[model samples]
Target: MLRYGLVVFIALLLSGCEMFGKKDIRLPIDVVSLQYDPYNYSMAELDRNATAACIAKGGTEAVAVDNEINTESVRWAYMNFNCYR
Candidate 1:
C-alpha cells in the first residue's frame, strides 16, 4: 500500500500537477558573504578619504584622485575608519 501511494505521488510530481509542463524550482542555499564589485563613480566618502590622504601628504584635497576608488579598497578603508570611531 505504501509503495503504491509513493508511486502515485511520484507520478503526479513528474506530470507537473497535470497542468503546466515541468516547473523550474529554485532552492535556497546558505550564503556566508556576498560581495559586489564597487563601481568607479565617485561618492562623498571617496573624496574625503583621498583628501585626508592628500592633506597628510601636504597637498590640497583637490589633488586627490578625481576618480572612484575600487570597491574592495573602499570597503576595507570604510571598515578601518569605522573601527577607529
Candidate 2:
C-alpha cells in the first residue's frame, strides 16, 4: 500500500509539470494580412508580394498562413513569419 501511494504521488507530480510548465511561454509569430483583386493578380503573385512585405518588415522567413477569396469580389492572403537578428 505504501509503494502504491508513492507511485501515485510521483505520477501526479509529473503530470502537474506537464500541465503548468508551458505557461506564458510561446514562440513569436509575425502575421501579415493583405487584400488584392484576383482580376489583377494571381495567387503566386500575391504570395510573392506578401513574402516581400514580411521581409521588408525584418522577418527572416515568410510562409502563407491562410487565404480567402470572395469569388465575386476580392482575394485575401495571410502570411506568418519569424524575425531574426
Candidate 3:
C-alpha cells in the first residue's frame, strides 16, 4: 500500500511538470529585469515587442540604447531600452 501511494504521488507530481514542453522563447527585452537581447527574435519583432511592452507599462516609446553582457556569458545586442514617457 505504501509503494502504491508513493507511485501515485510521483505520477501526479511529474504530471504537473512540463518536462517535455517547448523551451521558453527568448524575448528581445525583459521589461522587469531590464534585460534585452536579439537572440531568436528579429529586429522588427524585437522593436514591436519592446515598444508594446514599454507602452503597456505607461511609456510612450522604447529606444534601444547599448549592448551589454551578463555574467552568464549571454550577449545582449540591445542591452536595454530607454523608455520615453
Ranking of models by lDDT: 3, 2, 1
Best by lDDT: 3
Which ranking of candidates, highest TM-score first?
Answer: 2, 3, 1
Q: What C-alpha lDDT, on a 0 to 100 scale, does residue 4 get in candidate 3? A: 100
Q: Which window of 10 residues has the lowest lDDT sum in candidate 3?
A: 25-34
Please write out the lDDT profile of model 1 over residues 1-85, one tens digit for every residue: 9999999999989787667865655332211111223553344655566456545544443222223346555543221111110
Query: Each prediction's TM-score against the native?
Result: 0.28, 0.43, 0.42
What is candidate 2's CA lDDT for residue 63?
A: 61
Screening candidate 2 with a backbone cut-off below 3 angstroms (N, C-alpha, C), the clashing residue pairs are none
lDDT of 3 at 54: 86
Model 2 Cα displacement at 23 (Å)?
A: 21
